[model samples]
Target: MNEMEIVADRGAWRAGFEERVLAGYRAAGCSEPLARALLERAAKGIDDWTVATDGTEWTAVGVTQENGAAVGRIHDLTAPQGRAWAERWCAGQGAQRVEVRLTGGAGAFADYPVRGQNRMRAAAERPELPPGLTVRRLTEEEYPGWYAGEEAAYIADIVRAGALTPEQAKEKSDHDFALHLPQGYLTPGHAFYAMEADGQVIGTGWVNHGFLPGVTFGFSLEVYEEHRGKGYGRAAMAVGEWATRRGGDEVMMFNVFGGNEVAMGLYDSTGFAVLDEFRFMEL
Candidate 1:
């Protein structure tokens, strides 16, 4: 395949790119507000390092240098030829590995050895909670400890996935909590919950009703260590979907880091479909 030339018409390229990003998310059932936010975050840091064709293809590439190794992130790549060009370009730019975020579907990129992050969604419907399983809102006293533990675990997951360094993860963790839960346990659109089965605490989860307009977002769903393999995760999901529908939302969505096969399998078997993916390939 011939290498794609650098696109000089940045204005037109950006407009088309933004349109595709929005269309992909909307087609995956995201509301207009959520789609726009995704587009804004995706298009924030394009520089001269990007590669594109004048027609319908573009890849905005960002390179990060950490611990003397260069890693590349390629966004919105549209074709097999474009992928080929991006690999060569990134390798030439000293990137040891490249992570590509693709919208719509993987198509030809399916053979890549590694996957990064994914956004998954399912239609919201009230579900019957497993027998003896119940959920209750976390008390103000419980919120602080829950939030701290959850934040640490989340930061660890992203860092392990190579999506961010420790420093970057900490910064993002602080910013996300400040933005999403500014009022702690009383945040109007956010709810934190503890799950109990037969009066024994088994897990905790949280959800946000305002982030995606008409969609309810599950920020976290965790079953404690001793509670695994007993269908508690599924039970927690049932509670979340019930809460989502009770709040009048029609769709439920959440993000999970790649390589978490157990979590991915649970989500998939419970009717969640992947809407977007960041696929990783070692150069």
Candidate 2:
């Protein structure tokens, strides 16, 4: 437990971390087909805070904070070895407790903070677009409203999932939207839009064609509070599928945090299959 190294580069020590990671996700509930490229992306661009054991190979991937506490993920590692690596990493971090996420076959590292679950979903077939509803590219003028609603929804979501307090959620959501959302829908390879019926903006949504080549991901679909229960959200998802298909894709994927049965029900109603459930633990 004293000298294990945890480095990045997707944990090259493992032959098939992606498959093993997907297996873990599957064991947790994800039904959507995950690609190695996606997991590979997760391993890139974090060398400074990363760990490297013996420099002979990488056993895990994580970052060390200013406090010397290591926090990140380990993939395709067995329990006994993973446990040892974790304890050693914590010691190296000069931390009494190191928080890490385990993928592949390793289970919980005994008493840790259980981050809530996220349910992954996917639908390859487009749903029927509700009659009289339409979607259009988001205009510059509506960006303000869209950002506000998205941040509010984001805060509510994480708070509900117990990942953040209301205050922290607000701050993080604010920061995230600024970093992730565009000023308008002019970005190539991504599409964002507003759903209108008779020229009224009932909701907003977006589809990321960049998620995977020819494959689209429904990033967000939110119907206004007042518009709830009128089937507007469902229509938005259908439009999301249509947009993905327009990009030459037959499927779309998304996730709903655990406890959002309303969203789970809606995805089911729209013909999306529950693919997996993903959770995190903080040690």
Candidate 3:
């Protein structure tokens, strides 16, 4: 892992760094499209990234200030030298603590809690509905419900995960505000739906088909606060699984924070198996 360089802010910079990161991600079992998506999604304007090589082979791809600290996605975590380089890189960034994120939860099936993230999956079948429960495409008239529900769900999850205080969540909520929910609000690669029971709205779910076949990535679901604990979350996932299956997918995969026991229970009871468990260490 020697000869590592700051490549950031350098001319012809794109070739070496992005390639190494992309290569490392691919070598780590990520599909090419998924690898590119991960790179495209690294924090915008992050000017600190590091790289290591064995001549032509990319040994590591490191970034600083991701969600606020430095970390590396090494191609070979087993190599002592690569891990050593990661330590040096994070320290160079003045990181009080560094966290190495293993996407897709490589930890659940393996050793230690260090890799504790669950990449869950369930085969698509017409999920059984609770008595009187159903789902439909969210109508334009449901904008108010959608807006309120999404905000509450987003804030609740972050707050519960200790990622934000209530006030902070509120402030970040409007980072992408929609003063009004437009009719037919469709985003490519995403679909939103409303869950119903006895013809009344119970919850909202947002879903997307991600790379790696047969997997519908996640359901950003929120049941009205008063309506939770009555099986809406599970029903929402069932509906989501069905939707993905209808669209020709065989498996529906998703992740919830390790601390989200309620959500974890819903998935586990609904037959999703833990494929990975992720753990983060503040180094």
Candidate 4:
């Protein structure tokens, strides 16, 4: 596994990197689409590459790669050769901080690591997810509401953690908000379930379909703080799992901040296991 010798064009580089990462992920018996999604996100603004000598795989983002110094998340990095190649490449680019992020089945190097890992210290405990809360697929018409809920949940958590002032929160929350659901981003059959009590939405969960051939990605569960203790998270997750499996997805996956104990506990109780450990090293 020597460094890639022939650099590829931007699109070609992304595809090549994704293919190699997916191969590694599938070899590990992980989902392919999930791995692809992570790679797509990493390709957002990346440029530069170190082609592998064998011409089969390449180190897509090297130290000499300059796509801006902002935080970057790599979807997967199963190839030790590629990872080592990237390490050397980034070192040459004067990368002050580099994080090798592995998500789904792909991997990438980040110029800046996620700062402060203390936000989710009070991990939500796994409550007994209740029953009788009707869960169903989300209609296109309901996407707006779902998006709002997702934003609100994220904003609320950030505020609760004292990570941002109200003004800062609003500004940060509004940036590229529409990107949450770009056209053709998620399939209609993708599941988005809401827990209703008295005909009102109390909790919500959803799964995003993967870009790879057969993987299904699950995430975006938001239970109002008021509804936190009554087992809603578990219930929502159970519904989500059912929906994911119903969609022909064999494995379901989601990411929780390391400090989020409550979500971790809930997922653990529902038979979810930690597949990998990723750290956010800041510059």
Candidate 5:
């Protein structure tokens, strides 16, 4: 078997890779806006990419090849050609792990030599409220602090689980959570919210306008670890959904890792149905 050649053409591949991955996401039933925003993150250099012989785009941290296959590290891949290309990459590169994000029908193809398969769960409908909690929009002044708290909680969870070292977690957490800012909040079609108790924030969530049209996406929900299983996550989700519905969109969508059973249950109990599943593979 010939070693498949893998090349990184960041300049030429960047835009097309973003578009194709996002397009593949939409084809797999993801909302247009959510797909676009996810792609936008890739475009902003937050992700990387490589092109294959069939014109399929593969987004990842890097790429290589071995044993007639082309291998790459990726966040997601939805196109059939893209998936096949990845398989070839894996075979050729002797990749031990290939993190892939797959959606819809592509999930069934996991038999192609990956270590394990995980589902990416999503909620595309409005969320329901539990009791004794209220949901409200979060203002800009409040988001930064809220985001920081959320980041800390996330880091704490990962550290405890040994999924991330403290230094690695710190580096990953240093983001301007406000980058999406008012767009995820103040826009007439978007809403960001935080759950509060006696003037102190407990959890946070938000819905952004459709990345395209006629569809909306949700993000940024986080609850302090101490507050886990207490219904704060659900309340925050409900608040985001209510805002999306109020903005005139009928559907509200959000994604979760399949292995995150706690979160999957939270969304499931709040009226969110599983519309699609994606897998993350790392090479």
Candidate 6:
């Protein structure tokens, strides 16, 4: 097959790009509003979009910089030689540390070892909570302190991932944080829980509905530093899943950042399977 030509054309690329993103979000069980919000944020860099095409077929991709390194998003890429074209195209943009990301794992990009995010799912199982452990609503008095720490840690992680500058990460994190907790701890569709073991608070987690028709979104799970490695994380997850099932959701799903082996191991051991992934490769 002849090599495809890569050219800039945001107008032609925008529709397909939106379609691909929406489809991926749908598969990951995101609510329509949240998916649209995410799509809007994603379109911010469309000025850098390029189309790789022959006369009969095409794919759209956008490249942008993250912490001085090049990052590319390829949308519904199906052309045989599209990967080669994307590599050269990114390099031409003066990228030494180049990476190409896609919404889902396509065989065409199998060489992409890094996963940016994983949408994983498991059947809701009503496991017995570890002895002497209980999950309870996060009281209003505790919400503020909990969220402050959570947001700080999240911003730090984003910075460490080299996916955004500290300022950008904080802004993005706050925007998303507000979207989920518009009413703070009293948010209508969300449930924030504090995990207690032997009458002592040991961890926290949250879950929400409406992200998908009947799937519950497990939002956050954290075990305090002093509580790490004591199996509280797994126990917290089990309670979360049980709560999800009790709320009428048959499946519980959540997203995990790639390379977070500790979290991944916890989820995998607790019966979760990767339903979809945002795959990438650094060139």
The model with the greatest TM-score is: 1
Give the per-residue lDDT of model 2 (tens digit) for 255-283: 57645778877876766654433444444
Clashing pairs in model 2, backbone N/Cα/C closer than 3 A: 5-53, 6-51, 7-51, 29-275, 29-276, 29-277, 30-275, 30-276, 31-275, 31-276
| Top candidate by lDDT | 1
Misplaced by over 4 Å in model 5 are 1-71, 74-97, 105-131, 139-144, 156-166, 175-179, 182-191, 196-202, 223-233, 257-259, 269-283
TM-score of candidate 6 relative to the true fold: 0.74
* Model 4: worst 10 consecutive residues (lDDT sum): 115-124
Count backbone overlaps in model 6.
Answer: 0
Any idea what lDDT model 6 has? 0.71
What TM-score would you give candidate 5 relative to the actual structure? 0.55
Q: List the residue pairs that clash in candidate 6.
A: none
Global Cα lDDT for candidate 3: 0.57
What is the alpha-carbon lDDT of model 5 when measured against the actual structure? 0.54
Per residue, candidate 4 scores C-alpha lDDT tens digits across 32-55 of 564455456545545533444335
Which sections of candidate 4 miss by over 4 Å? 1-28, 31-47, 50-68, 71-96, 102-130, 137-145, 155-180, 183-191, 198-200
The global Cα lDDT (0 to 1) of model 1 is 0.76
Q: Mind giving the per-residue lDDT tens digits that candidate 3 earns over 1-283?
A: 3454433334344456566557655654555666576567542333444544433433344544433334434322323355556666656656544444454445322332342244545544665656688777777677676767677766666566554458866765655334322232655566677788877887777766653554566646667677888867777777777767765666566657556877677776877665434444344
Ranking by TM-score: 1, 6, 2, 3, 4, 5
Q: Which stretches of candidate 3 lie over 4 Å from their true place?
A: 1-61, 66-76, 80-85, 103-118, 163-184, 209-214, 275-279
RMSD of each: 3.5, 5.5, 6.2, 8.0, 7.7, 4.8
Q: Once superposed on the true structure, which residue ranges of model 2 sit more than 4 Å away at CA?
A: 1-12, 16-19, 22-34, 45-61, 64-76, 80-127, 182-185, 197-199, 268-278
At residue 153, what lDDT does model 1 achieve?
Answer: 84
Q: Please report, as a residue range, the 10-residue window in candidate 6 with the lowest summed lDDT.
A: 96-105
Clashes of each: 0, 10, 10, 18, 19, 0
Model 5: per-residue Cα lDDT over 1-283, one tens digit each: 2222355554555566566667666765656775675566544534444444334443243454422334455544434455656655655556644544444444634643322222223334655665666667777888667666766765664454333357765654553344545343355655667676656667777566653454457755677566777757766766665666666666666656344667766776766655444343444
Error of 5 at 27 (Å): 7.5
